[model samples]
Target: MALLETLAVVFAVALVAAVAVYIKTKLFPLGDGEEIREDVAEYISMMVSVFYALVLGLCLVSVWDNRATADDRVQAEASALHQTYLLADALPAEQRGPVREAARSYAGHVVDVEWPLMAEREPLGDDGWTLLDRLRTAGELRGPGTTAQQIAAQEVLAQIGYVDDARRGREAAAEERLSVVLWAGLVIGGVLTVAFMFLFGLNRSSTHVILVMGLSGFIAFTVLLIHQLDTPFGDPLGVGPDPFTRYFRL
Candidate 1:
C-alpha cells in the first residue's frame, strides 16, 4: 500500500511537470534560441542532480545498515536462547525441567506472537517480557550441591543473561525507523530533482518526455526501497523468524 501511494505521487508529479513544460514550450517558446539560458539550466541541473544523488545514497546506506543490524539481533537472541536450553542439562534435575521449559516457551512466544507484532510495527506487550522474566527466574538456582553443580548454575545464569540482553536488543531493532525529518528531505529532494529536469532545454519533445518518465520512475523505486528497508520487520524484504524456528523447531 505504501509503495503504491509513493508510485502514484511520483507519477502525478512527473505528469504534471511534463505537461506544464510542453504547454510552456508551445505558448512562450524559447527566446531567440538563447545559448545563455541553456548554459545556466545545464549547470543548475547538474548541481542539483549531484546533490540529490548524494542524499539518496546516504539514505540507502542508513536503512541498509539498520536492516542488517536488526537481522543480527534476531540471530543473537535466538542463539542465546538455544545456548540456555542446552545448559539446562548441567543444572540440578529439579531446576533443569523448568528452565528448559521456560526457554522453549519464550522461543515459541517470540516466533508466534512477537513476530507478527513486529512486522506490523506494533508493541509486543507484556507477555514477551513476562516470559523472559520466567526464564530468568528459572535460572536463578542458588548454591548447587557440588562444585560441578555450582559451575553449571553459573553457566546457566550467564546464558540467561545473554538471552535477556539479546531480547531487549531485538525489540529495539523491531521498533527502529527513519525519522520524520529524513522522510521530509527524501520527498522534497525527489521533487526538486524531477522538477529540475524540466528546466533544461531539449530540442526533441519525445526525448524530454521519456527522460521525465524514466527519472520519475527511478526516484519512486528508490524511495520505495528505502521505505521497505526502514522497517526491518516489513514483509517480502523483512527479516524472518528463521533463527527462532531453526533453534526451537517452531
Candidate 2:
C-alpha cells in the first residue's frame, strides 16, 4: 500500500479501538476498591515501553544506515565512471573516443534505465552489463602502445573495476530490508503498548481519549518512517540518480 494510505489505516484502527475501549469502560465502571495496583501496572507498562522503544530505535538506525550506504555506493559508482571518462583523454586517439563514448553510454543507461528499475525493486537486464563490457573492451591495451596510453588504459580498467564493485553494492543495498519477524514484533509491540495504556483508569474520559489518540498517532508515524526507509530506492524517500546526473551532466 502507499505510505499515506497505510498510515491512515493504522491511525484509524487505533482510534476506533481506543474509542471502543473508552465506551466499554464507561458502561462498566469499576466498583469502589476494585482497582488493580496502579504502581505495579505502571512499572510493568514502563518496562514494556522501554523495550519497545529500543526495538524501534534499532530499526530506525538499521534502515538509515542502509539508505546512507546505498547513496554512497551510487556516488562511488558515478565518480569511478567520471574518472574513467576523464582518463580516456590520455589514450591513443584510435582508442580514446570509443572508451569515452562507452563510459558515457554506461552512465546514461544507469541513470535512465537502471534507476527506475531499482525504484521498483526490479532486476536490471543485461543492457548495463553489455555497456560495461563495451567499455572494458575499448580500454583493452594491445601490445606496443605509447607509455602514456598504456598507463591511461590501466587506470581506465581500475576505474571500471571500482564501478563494478560499487554497482554490486548498490544492487545489494536496494534489496536489503528488515526481516519479517522484526516487522511482526514492531506491529505487535505497538498494539500491546497502546493496550497497556487502557489498563490505567484516568479520572477524565476526555483526557484518556486524547492520550490514546496521540500515542497511536505517534506509533503509526514511526512505523511509516521505518517503512519509507525499508526500501532505499522507494519513491519520495529513496535515493535519486543525482550522482550520475551531476557527474555526467545528464
Candidate 3:
C-alpha cells in the first residue's frame, strides 16, 4: 500500500485506541495505587516533542529550498525573455516589431494569466508556447553572412531554448507533490505526539486542562504550517508572484 494509506490506517487505529482507553479509564477506575508513572510520562513527552520539532524543521527546510528554486527559475526565465525581446532588433525592421510585440505579449500573458495560474498550481496550455514559437519564427533567420549575425541568431535560439526549458522546469516543480512518505511521517508524528500526552493519566484536573489546551494548540500550528508550505503560492507564507510582475511594468 502507499505510505499515505498505511499511515491513514495506523492513525485510525491509534485514534480509536486512544478514545477507547480514555473512555475505559473514565468508566472503570484502576486499583487505588495503580496509575501511570509521572517521571516516565515526562521523559517520553519530552523526547517525542523534540523529535517532532526535528521533523518539522526538516520539512520547513525542504519546502524553503523548493520555494527558492522556483523563484530563481522564474527570474531566469523573465531575464531570458527580456534578452530575446531586445535581440529582435537584429531582425529585419519589418520583422522586428512583430517579434518584439509577440515577446511582449507572451510576457504579459505570463504575468497576467499564466503566473496566477502557476501560483494556483495550474499549467497554461500550448497556446502560451505557441505564441513564443511565433516570436521565434518572426525573424528571417539567414545563413552564415557575417559570423556576428549567425552568433546573434544562435544566441536568440539559445534564449528560446532557455524559455522552453524554464517552462518545463516550472511545470515539473509544480507537479512535485510532497512524497507520500513525508506525509505519512507527518501524520504518524502528529498521532504519536498526541499519544505521548496520554502516556500517563493526568493527576490533577488542572493538569488535564493544560495538556488538552497545549496539544490542541500544537496540532493547530503544525497543520497550518503544513498547509502554507503545501500551496507555496496561494497562502501568506507561500512563494510570491514577484517573478512575473517584475519582468513587465505590470
Highest-TM-score candidate? 2
- For each candidate, give its TM-score against the true structure: 0.83, 0.84, 0.75
lDDT (0 to 1) per candidate: 0.85, 0.89, 0.73
Candidate 3 residue runs with Cα over 4 Å from true position: 1-4, 8-38, 143-147, 198-215
Residue 41 accuracy (lDDT) in model 1: 73
Worst 10 residues of 3 by lDDT: 139-148
RMSD (Å) of each candidate, 1 decimal: 6.5, 7.1, 5.1
On residues 1-250, what C-alpha lDDT tens digit does candidate 3 reach at each position?
6985877787798899899989988998688899865786688689877887787777767776776677677777888888888887775556568868888888887777876776688867787888888877864475545566667777788898898787777666655666667667676687778877666676797998798779868876876677577665555776565755666666
Q: Which lDDT tens digits does candidate 2 get at residues 112-204? A: 899889888899888998999899999988777888888888898999999999988999998888876567668878998999999988999
Better of 2 and 3 by lDDT: 2
What lDDT, from 0 to 1, does candidate 1 have? 0.85
Model 3's C-alpha root-mean-square deviation from the true structure amounts to 5.1
Model 2 misplaced regions, further than 4 Å:
1-36
What is the Cα-based lDDT of residue 224 in candidate 1? 98
Q: Count the backbone clashes (under 3 Å) in each candidate.
A: 0, 0, 0
Comparing 1 and 2 by lDDT, which wins? 2
lDDT by residue (tens digit), candidate 1, 132-224: 889888887765467787887788778777877877888888888886556766887888899988877689999999999999999999999
Ranking by TM-score: 2, 1, 3
